[model samples]
Target: MDFARPLPEYLIKRYQGWRATTYSENKGWYRRLADEGQRPRAMVISCCDSRVHVTAIFGADSGEFFIHRNVANLVPPYEPDGDHHGTSAAVEYAVCSLKVSHVIVLGHSGCGGVQGCYDMCEGKAPELEEKTSFVGRWMDILRPGYEALDTGDDSVRVAELEKRAVLVSLENLWTFPFVREAVEGGTLSLHGLWTHIGEGGLEAFDPASKRFMPV
Candidate 1:
């Protein structure tokens, strides 16, 4: 408990500014949301990358999206073995409890997690190959996708792998019984998206073409 400390000076100042401006302007809306509870229409599973702002990209207001962020935006296949499952729990709550209509897996370029995964797979990151490495274990979810990748340049391969991570997550979502039921019952839909961090470009995965099309 002693490890916790007060906010940094800069963060404190930023928070105060937000409270004075944004909070003041949206006071009524904030109060309404607290009273009514969140009824988000979509659930976004995105990377832990600081640059991937799901709400900002969609111009969404508070409570408009149920978002879960994790390394490489991964979703492990359904494995109910009584172990702790953060992503699975989030998906269950979003699809079954909140009844969100859409679940979107959002991947982004220049993702450190994806880079780590690629390096680990290529045997260039021994630190991540240790049995005790949490990142390596979590990234094991992307192994199949990496193995299926077409031969190409390093840059192209990494870019394609980033989008492939989104597809992997989407596929895992289907493994969740609740998600599958919801989708098949016409109550929910799944989508995959990838973004270029530097270019501010986005692409949507087109199932028909099995490709990411510019958005």
Candidate 2:
């Protein structure tokens, strides 16, 4: 059953280059982080899209953020039925253990996962409807957001759905008692953000305006 292989040559070469330059130049910083362990100020739940570089967008360095990436960057409502909950576990650790001051949900434009969800919900993607499709099940988390979207052109609907993904996550995040308590106690805050991948533009959700304004 051995299917694993050595690192790809390109990846290895890149690692060697980074180690020779970045790591070498910041050896002390790396060493301190290794010994002191991570104490990030925020937890960022973001999409698995390679283009959405959270660190690069914020110009953050190592140990600055506790990032968790998943399909569409969705967060499920608190369901402690005892099954595997990767996102929930990360949230618990960040809010309870690490005691991060902020929890940020970041969505982006042209998200493949959101696009799939849009198609699945609109009955445009039959493959995603099968009972065995994990993606279909996962994307179910966004159904509420989909249903709430205003009827509009495909492009606008999809783009709005992307922002709704961030909103959905923020809403579900509060369903966790720990997160709610932390927020109520003024120890932690929740934020929603959306980025235009191509434009390199950012927007923040203002609960007051109930809109995403440019950042």
Candidate 3:
């Protein structure tokens, strides 16, 4: 298998077939809606890994979810300063502009960025500098999680830390004024989800239960 060439062509053809079927089967509903514009009901913040696809996981078709993907599923505290605010900007658009009812922070198992953080915390990796790289900077957001882990086993600790990171991101969402306002006004809800890729199931963070349960 030549990894690059065939895969791109295969996906393009697959999507073309899907589009044709969608138009014909829906009786031109998609065509009409295309002109009317999109109004997605929910927004998902997820990892940019190819294995974890937001739309596929949620069973969403086109215009169903407003998505933002980064190295790890992270939402940093809002800062009005002139930093490159990609995640913040996405959250602002989803909450303020799109007026999405629900915002989900979707984390997953075996995340490379989370693993990198674990490596750094263990002194297996070097401290990140500003000139280091984009991935290093991104993984820094999960430092609090890494520091909070008390488990003895490295693998267990990393997994727990990743889950903790999701909770952290959920709390960080409140840093944005618009998100806070919407949630307080009962117009918006935030959720944290962890995908167990090995099991092919999702564990949703239940605030009432205060634990993750199968979804």
lDDT scores of the candidates, listed in order: 0.93, 0.97, 0.86
Q: Which residue pairs overlap in candidate 2's backbone?
A: none
**Candidate 3 regions off by >4 Å?**
1-8, 127-130
**Candidate 2 lDDT tens digits, 109-160:** 9999999999999999999999899999899999999999999899899999
| Candidate scoring better on lDDT of 1 and 3 | 1
Judging by lDDT, tell me the better candidate of 2 and 3. Answer: 2
Top lDDT model: 2
- Residue 191 displacement in candidate 2 (angstroms): 0.4
Tens-digit per-residue lDDT, 17-128, candidate 1:
9999999999999999999999999999999989999998989999999999999999999999999999999999999899999999999999888888889999999999
Worst 10 residues of 3 by lDDT: 125-134
Cand. 1 TM to true fold: 0.98
